[model samples]
Target: MTDAPILIRSVEVLSDDWATLKKFTFDYRRRDGTLERQVRQTYDRGHGAVILPYDPERGTVLLVRQFRLPAYVSGHPGPLVEACAGLLDEDDPETCIRREAQEELGYRLRDTESVFHVFMSPGSVTERLMFFIARYSPDDRIGQGGGDRHEGEDIEVLEVSLEGALGMIDEGQIVDGKTIMLLQHLKLKGLMRASAHP
Candidate 1:
């Protein structure tokens, strides 16, 4: 709270089962002369990185389908179609995404360009995500990646037309927030050509 509008009065650990959940008690000073105390719960699971691997030559994008318990409990019928992503465990965003590319997508990505960093769920989650886009070719395929089974990751790789991926969002087939953001970001940046095909 050095230069923040709020001062942290106290912090209590609410849960540490998987991610660390804490309850923060803070005193917020208004623009006037009023000071108010507020409490907020935040979950911290560390930052992560996600990349959309697109083949400009083939006009296709590499995605992954995986089962998410939260999505299932929240009422999704089955697994979700999403970009290749992983937590930046002990590495930087670039390195983390490179490793995830191989572990989840079976692609060997060399150079990557970052699009942006975002706080997906600011109100309740204390995690930041880095979004990236990288070009790929058919020769970059290295192995059959489906993620680590011991970690409960049963991933299925998908190679779909860029146009089809955009259409899936309209049809509710792709609902992952970060994935949607990355796809739209590319569209807005004029990187993906709707007519490009391989």
Candidate 2:
């Protein structure tokens, strides 16, 4: 994958209130030796990390339910279930995830395995997420994490059976993309299994 055939023309900042949104105009060389002018807008909310906490012995996964204004405005009934995640800010992906784990789920995960990296919304969002999974036990619980109140966060923690969680997906209850992907990853890798079902 080489970008030698592409040439950038200009970039304009459209909005920079809470996040940076920019419009880019560029020239692209087609396979037929033709140049094309294209324009696109991208919103950059910064990169982040997501972690799914699993307890294989009990076949359980930890998730969070929190209100998302965007989802609500887009027609969601209420809060959305999602993996514990946060923006990297200036920290590394691992560090950011660990921080978010403690802040969102009250678990201080000892070790985490990176699953993959993905752009959650590539078409209009310039944000990439590093996906990770960690094993946690009851002993890992630390604080009563519901997020910092001052940040306008009112998160509700959920401890769900893997089977039940998957059912939620089929039932349209678990609509968060990142959370769904991580849950499917666990099922694919045989990381967590419902003993009765299989």
Candidate 3:
């Protein structure tokens, strides 16, 4: 068995905010009477959710393409195609995902199920992302959904076949990490089936 490290000292956070800088300090000890100290950094934390809506009969999936500043600044010149995703405010994970779907794609989801929850960048940020999956018919008419103009979101919804979507992943067209993880999960579970439209 390995020896457990001792906490010699620690620092606690009294308050934090979205735009405020924060820091944490920790002190530890080894079995040989040696002391060690480390400082961890954190930033404004947020939550995100990804939704994978599948149409079983059509073998298609709903995806959205949008402009992302992070991607654009990081060298990706083209828009990003990803599953419906958004930040969680004061609502539950499920509710946040449902609302994001409608706002981003104009699609209403039913019988949503949790796929997984992950931390996008735990080492430097406090963003927790929840992933979900739902079944929907592709034939359903989704009104124009481009997010709220006040929020500056202009999203384009796309319905592509499962094979095509997988191809996009292979071609690196779908570069969003959360979307990639959710698609992998669906493929692994063999739940990438199409639903019959009414």
Candidate 4:
């Protein structure tokens, strides 16, 4: 703890096609004062932002279904249900999520609440995601959102009741990490359920 915990020895580019992938050699200091050399490959796809837009009056939440190659490759038979999210190419977190909400969900975010920033996959992926939640009504929709066609995105928009969304989680229907987190957060906060129950 007294000295630097890690020391980088070398780095090599593994791939740079879509995102940057690099192999790193580093010296890691153990708790017992032993230094060990290790190698790790990291995929750098850049950080991103995700949002869950909820309609309190309707008790429903907006979501999307999209074809994720990685998920498909991992044995999922169909598109994954997920929150609206996008890589923060050049915009800040708030700006990134707002634009993503419009593009992927067709809803204009009026007031978004920042929840947290998390590394969904910290071991091999160097991408952090900012999480958010916001209120949306029927009037906020401004477009037919199916993601960017040029980007090969054919997203399906879904609006489900909050309780139904939770049931989907239990049934293993919604498996995306960010979506699960946001849904659970909303339920835990009792954002809409509290008033309904009382």
- Which candidate gets the maximum TM-score versus the true structure? 4
Please tell me which model should have the higher lDDT, number 1 or number 3: 1
The global Cα lDDT (0 to 1) of model 1 is 0.91
Q: What is the lDDT of residue 28 in candidate 2?
A: 79
* Model 1 bad stretches (over 4 Å): 1-3, 195-198
lDDT of 2 by residue, 75-186 (tens): 9979999999999999999999999999989999998999999998999998999999999988999988898788888989999888888999999999999999999999
Looking at model 3, the pairs that clash are: 55-194, 55-195, 56-194, 56-195, 57-194, 57-195
Mark the 10 consecutive residues where model 2 has the least summed lDDT. Answer: 189-198
lDDT string, candidate 1, 130-172, tens digits: 9999999889999999998899899999998888888999999
TM-score, per-candidate, Cα-based: 0.94, 0.95, 0.83, 0.95
Error of 1 at 22 (Å): 0.3
Candidate 4: tens digits of C-alpha lDDT, residues 1-198: 237999999999989988999999999999899999999999999999999999887788999999999899999999999999999999999999999999899889989999999999999999999999999988999998999999999999998888888889999999998999999999999886422311
Show the lowest summed lDDT stretch of 10 residues, model 4: 189-198
Predictions: Cα RMSD each: 1.8, 2.4, 4.2, 2.5
Off by over 4 Å in 2: 1-3, 193-198
Report lDDT per candidate.
0.91, 0.91, 0.79, 0.91
lDDT of 2 at 111: 86
Model 2 pairs whose backbones collide: none
Which segments of model 4 are wrong by more than 4 Å? 194-198
| Candidates 2 and 3 compared by TM-score, better number | 2
